[model samples]
Target: MRKQPPTYSPQMTRMAFAASFAFAITAPAHAQSTVTLYGIIDEGVNYTSNVQTSAGHGHNLYSISSGILSGSRWGLRGVEDLGGGMKAVFVLENGFDVTNGKLGQGSLEFGRQAYVGLSTPFGAVMMGRQYDPVVDYVHPLMPSALFSGSIGAHPADLDNLNNANRINNSVKYRSANYGGFSGEGLYSFGGTPGSVGTNQIWSVGFGYSSGPLNLGAGYLVARNPNVSFFGTAVGATAASNNFGSSPVINGYASAQSQRIFGAGATYAIGRATLGAIYSNTQFRHLSGAISPLNPAGVEGTATFNSIEADFQYQFTPALSLGVAYNYTAGNNANDAKYHQGSIGADYAVSKRTDFYLIGVLQHASGIDSTGHAARAALNGLTPSASNQQAAVRIAIRHKF
Candidate 1:
C-alpha cells in the first residue's frame, strides 16, 4: 500500500547524479591516513686554533662545516591505524654532508634511523637499527644537547651516552609514561655468522619528568669492535684511529671492549632549565690493537668521568640563549683531562626557520704524545698530532 514516488525527467535525474558526484570529489577527506615529511638542515663555519702545522709552513685553515651547529638530517615518519588502540609506526632518517653531499660516516643509507615498530598500551617495542637506551634516555640532559656546538661530543664518541649516536641490529623496548616516569632497554646482536658474540652491545636506562624537574640514568656495553688495517697511515686518519700504523697488531685486535654508566638531571627555574650530567667509561681487554705506540698487545686501560652543567633562558617568545660547561677526566694511558664551555643564541625567523650563533672553547691537560690528540680529525678533518685545540661556529637552520 505504498504511495507512488514522484517522477522525474531523464535529464533531471542525470543532473542530480552529477551534482552528488561533484560533491564527493570536492569533499574534505576525514578518514584517510596521513604521512608527514620532515627534515632539519644545520650548517656553519668553523675556526680551529692550534691546528697542526706541517714543517715550517704556517697555514691558517678556515672552512664551512656541516653538523657543527647541528646534525643535518631528513626523515619520513608515518603511522597506520590498526584499530583497538593499536597502531604501526615507522621512521626512516638519513644523515648527510651538506657541504659535499655525502652520507654520514659508517651509515650506508638511512644512517641516522630506520625502524618499524608497533605501539600499544603495554608500551612500544621496536627492531632493526635504533638508538641505544643510553643515547635515548641519557643524552638530553647534557650541554651538547642544549647548545648547538661540536665541542660537546666526547672523545671518539666512545659511549652511546650524551646522545653521541645510534647503533644497528638492535631490538629496543620502551615503556609508556608512568606517573612522570618511564624507561627503556635495548640489545644489539653482532649478527656475525658462526661468531655470535663479536661486536655486540646492550643497554638499559630510565627517566623521570615531573613538574619542573627531569632526571635520567643509563648503562651500556660494547664488545669486540672490529678494526681494519691501512698501510703507512701512521697518524689518525680521516677514517679511524691511527692504531693501524703498528706492525705487531697490523690491524685492530679482536675483543676490544667498553662499558659505561651515566646519569643526568634537569631543573626548571623560571624561564630557564638547568641541567647536569656525569658519565664513566671503562675500556678493557684492548690488546692486539695496533697503535703507533702499543703495537704488541698493549693492555693499558682507560677511564673517563665527565661532568656537565648548562642553562637555557628564553629571551623572547621567539628567541632563546643557552650556556654550558663540561669538565672531563680520564685515568688511562694518557691521563687526559678536558674542559669545554659554550654559549649560544637562537632566534626564530619563522615557525620553521631559525638563526643561531655559538661559541665554544676546549682545553686539554695531560694529553701525552701517545695519547689521543685534541685534533683527532673528526667529520673528515685530517688527523693531526694531539695538541690543544679550540673552535667556534655559527649557523642557520630550517625544519619542515
Candidate 2:
C-alpha cells in the first residue's frame, strides 16, 4: 500500500505484499540506472448479510471479489543515480480488478500513481496524481491497513483511512528520516479556470519511530470537496457521488469544504502488536437538492469523529491473527453512531504469497448522513438492509 517516491519511505509491514524486480544498466559515463517491475493479485470469495436495495430494503449477497486485502495492481519504477547523493526517480502504477480485468480508481490508466522528481539526501518532491499525506503517514498505522484491511475501516472509511480517493495535479514532498522522524506535505491544484478557491486541497503528515513504537499524525483540508476530493465529474452532484452513497459521508458530498485530521500510535510487545487511532472529519456549508446525500436538504455543517483499537498476535512464523474494534459518531445531519469489529487470520506460504480469512460485523444507530435511519456500511460494499451487518471472506494475495 505504500509507494516509495524515492524508495526511502517508512513502512510498517505485517504480512504486507511488497515485492519487485529490478533491471540495471550502465548509462553514459557509467551513471548507474535501474528500472523495476512490480505487481500484485488478490482474489476472494465473500458473503455479506443484509445488503440494502433501491427500495429501501435489503438482501444477503454472495460473490467473488477482487483486491480485498489489497488492490490488484502493477507498476514500473525507475531510478537513475545523478552522483553526490542525488538521483532521479519516477513511478507509474496501475490499479485493476483481478476478477473483471478492468481498471480501478475511476478507470484512469496509471490512476493509482504517476509521479517523477529528484531525490536528494533531504527528500523527494514529485508532481502528478498522488495520494495525500494522510495516506502516506497515518493510514499505515490504522487497523484497516496494518491488519484486517478495508473491512476493518471505520464506517464508510469516512476519514479516508481506506484510500478511497487520490489527489490530481498534485506536488508532494516526503522528508528524509532524521532521528527516527519523517514527514510529508502535499498540495493539489484545482485546475478549474477563474476560481482558485473552487477546487484546492492541501495536507501535511508526520511520523516518528523508535524501537517498537510508531506514531503518526496528519491533517488535510479541501475546498469544494465534492469536485476536488471526490471527483470532478460533469453535473453538480455527480462528482461527489464518486465517493459512493454510504450515508456516513454521502450527505456531506456537497460540502463547500472538508477537513480531516488523524493521529495514531502502535507498539509491539513480544509476539503481539497493538494500535489505536483517532480521526476527526468535518464538512462545512452543505449544499444541494434533496438527493441521496441530502435527503433532508439540511443546510449546515456536519462532523464525524472516529476511533479504533486493534491487536495482532503472531502465533507462528507462517500464521498470524488480528482483531480490531472501531467507533464513529456523527452530528449535524444526524446523531449517528457506528460500531464495527473485525477478525482476521492470515497464513503466509512464502515471502510473496499469503492466504487470509476475515470476518466483520457492524451495527449502526440514529439518523445517518442522508437523514434516514443509520445503516451498517462497510468500506467498498453496499450498505446493510438493517442496522446490523455481518460478512466473511477467504482470500489469497500474491505479489510479484
* Best model per lDDT: 2
How many residue pairs clash in each candidate at the backbone level? 2, 0
lDDT of 1 at 189: 84
Candidate 1 per-residue lDDT, tens place, 124-213, comes to 988876777777777777666667455555544445454434667788899999998899988888766998777677889999999999
Query: Could you estimate the TM-score for every candidate?
Result: 0.81, 0.90
Location of the lowest summed lDDT over 10 successive residues in candidate 2: 15-24
- Single out the weakest 10-residue window by summed lDDT for candidate 1: 227-236
TM-score of model 2 vs. true structure: 0.90
Model 1: per-residue Cα lDDT at residue 253: 30
* Position 240, candidate 2: lDDT: 38
What tens digits encode model 2's per-residue C-alpha lDDT throughout 67-94?
8788899999999899899999999999
Clashing pairs in 1: 243-290, 373-386
How does each model score on lDDT? 0.66, 0.85
Give the Å error, residue 17, model 1. 19
